[model samples]
Target: MVTLGLVFAGPCLVAQQAMGAGTDEVLQAQLTQIAAQHHGKVAMFAEQLNTGKTVGLDPDKPVQTASVIKLTILFEAMEQVRAGKAHWDEPIVLKPGDAVSGSGVLMFMDAPMTLTLKDALTLMVILSDNTATNLMIDRFGVDAVNQRIAWMGLKDTHLYKKIMKPATEPMPADQPKFGLGKTTPREMAKVMERIGRCELAAPGEPALPGDAAICSVALHMLRNQFYRDTIPRYLETLDSTEEGSGIASKTGSLNAVRNDVAIVAGKSGPMILSIFTYDNQDHSWTVDNEGEVTIARLAKAIVERWSPAGIDGKTLVPGLGLAPVAGGGIGASK
Candidate 1:
């Protein structure tokens, strides 16, 4: 449901010739085919930040956020620090009640341990730590987080409860509609955009001098993202940290849902993308799960089609980054 103002306005208008008309035609055709052939629901929103060329496919449709909504928590944490309501270096003691399962090493560690609020935020984003998330949520106040979302003028984004909260805990009747949290691809993309632009903090709250403070921390944590099964799966600079521009992203995965939003530093400029897959029939958790593979392929296709200039010429083909390699050429699969 993204506006798709330029993509659908009339001609296949492009701000710059990153890629030509013929390539854009093929790319749009492939995206259409991808949406049509996907096994379940798919929503995406992408924009080249400088050029404003864009694409969307059901980008406004509501979807289960899985762990992706932790971003709101991250934003709120940054806000709290800026407001002096919380301190990033404040000490937090881990208790038995704080432990929760799924996608984090915190649960496996000993309880009654201690870490700073900043450390918890790091684990929350980099590891998707449910316990770290819940700890920070308690400090950040769940309602306060939602209020900030509304204040920022986003409607479909909301957090329902702490990660893996019990059924006995008080929550709204619609909690079942979106587990943990919910958001649209477009909304999530905007969140990233604000964070990237360093505009997430409250107005007049002394901006964090040029991505050196909160903005840098948030992006650094995202750049260290441990999960690479989706968005970064196809980028040329997946492993080596220094050779090429890196992907800063957060990914969420549930059995039936896989979502990722990222800010890619393209060779020419920055590009933002958000993609979500849900209601998927294939719920396998394998590296080759259908939904995961779908997102991975779609991400690569978008980059190749729209920003051919950004593509690293020596990288492997779109999805076969791990295939045995010979010195073929730029797009060589093996």
Candidate 2:
């Protein structure tokens, strides 16, 4: 029997906050009330890029990441392309055995079809395609993704295996605890911050020149992410399919868990929100799943508190207008 009171923690668990003076105590109070009212455990970390104001609940606590770990895979693909190790146009073949049923269109498509590496990656992000995710893992290797996570100085984040597949190597003691992967709210937010800032290289490493192009493509997929019921539920004003949205996000879900990490191009500045909910009593797979709504409420409160004027999609197109990074020719979404 599962319990709703479990609070997963890691050795790195410590109070993490940098809210400057005049911090929004009311906003924090609102967040606390929202978390307490939910029928599940919540962990979150959010930061405003311009002011560095932040609010968090168990920011460093490790939790089941579900499909959210795909962000690391997407990150690795970007770095590999930047490092000349992989090409976006590289061909990837998907046989019948590669198809796995969950959340994607690839399983219903004809088998043995060929797709470019970029296509698989886009599906992995926009649609959360499990088969597409497996193709990427097979091409790049899961260990490589973990290596990149380590390079980013994220200790609690790990991509344990591919989607719906068994691990062939030795398993960690906590393998069964977090099915596909695991991460802390703070660590995952760090990943989004890196992409938002277009800072690809690891800390202290010489910056990779001409790598802003890589960030553009990654952001493009994230901006077009198909699952919007979480963070984007109350943030988007226009149909993202037609006009594009100011939110670039990736969401993950399980029966009792829902997670979303996003980079928002707000009116004031860019903001990053990483939220995870677990031990939820509501396990229904409906749009109104309690965990999902909980995440959206948290996001709405945080964004409303910080960017009272709302988000600007225009800033998103130019890579959040981040310094030393500019626009690129991103392929149109299918």
Candidate 3:
């Protein structure tokens, strides 16, 4: 890797490199180059669900969330369902005013279309439906979402407002800096990790508080996501005939920002990858946008270097991390 008198090594990596054990030179170098290829800022965080091996490039740096913030809304809804405060089958009415266009079928539908919270959640992810996303924010209040995030102990993750709407209340000073919402890649990766573990619960492994069923529903919806232009772009299994290997991911994009958070099933186990790019010079919404392609290539590289074979439709144990590392820090650049 091109170490400019300093390297962007995370805690586990730096410690391993010290013991002459970790630091996959070739992989790290490739990852560094991938970040450089983007004409904007990039941040990434990945963890081996089984071994807990991690990789980070500016993972802790806060960045624009775009539609990725919708994940928070989804999560809060899941928690509410678990707490009996909400139901997936609960009906949500879509009025004429709810139609705020960008990405979704709501605008095309007639006024007062009805949909269950479950179905709306699915559309919000699969289609990046701005209208459904706004409906969700209204049903699940913005304050509740922020409170849930705080209760989850995620300081850097915050939802600023509903999509395409003015903020109802005062927001933090940084809200303008990160559009719609804000979160660090590392924090988001941790959230994805929890989702992966929750979905991978073994039989008779006493159900956790959140309920594995909730996790299963969310994962299934993510797997059906319509946007494959980012992380899953260059993958081979996507072209397969059978529903063998599965990938549960949520992708977010703006004209100048692209982000994807996913739990990719691997032969060994699931890998959680959260990557974000902002201030991109290329703002095209095309499938082959440079930023989108960069994320896809980076994802391919991580999977190839870490989980290279077949999944065989088997679930592997979740490995948190091999060993504790020294200090962990994020790398920053102008």
TM-score of 1: 0.82
The ten-residue window of minimal lDDT in model 3 covers 325-334
Give the TM-score of each candidate: 0.82, 0.89, 0.83
Error of 3 at 231 (Å): 0.9
Candidate 2 local lDDT, residue 173: 90
Candidate 2 segments whose C-alpha is farther than 4 A from its true place: 1-23, 317-319, 322-334
Better of 1 and 2 by TM-score: 2
Tens-digit lDDT track of model 3 for 115-184: 9999899889878899999999999998999897787678899998888888888888998788888998
- Determine the backbone clash count of candidate 1: 3
Q: After superposition on all CA atoms, what RMSD does each candidate show versus the true structure?
A: 8.7, 5.4, 9.3
**151-234 in candidate 1: lDDT tens per residue?**
778999988888777644577766788888889888999888887767855566655543336666676677667787787787
Clashes of each: 3, 0, 2
Which digits, one per residue and each the tens of the lDDT, describe model 2 over residues 1-334?
A: 2111223243212233344463565776678678877877888988898887877877788999988899999999988898899999999999989999899899999999999999999999999999999999999998899999998999999989877788889888998999899999999999988888888876677766667678878888898888999999998887777666688899998898999999988888888999999988899999999999999999999988899998875447434573322331132344
Report how far residue 274 has shifted in candidate 1, in Å. Answer: 0.7
Q: Please tell me which predicted candidate would have the highest TM-score against the true structure.
A: 2
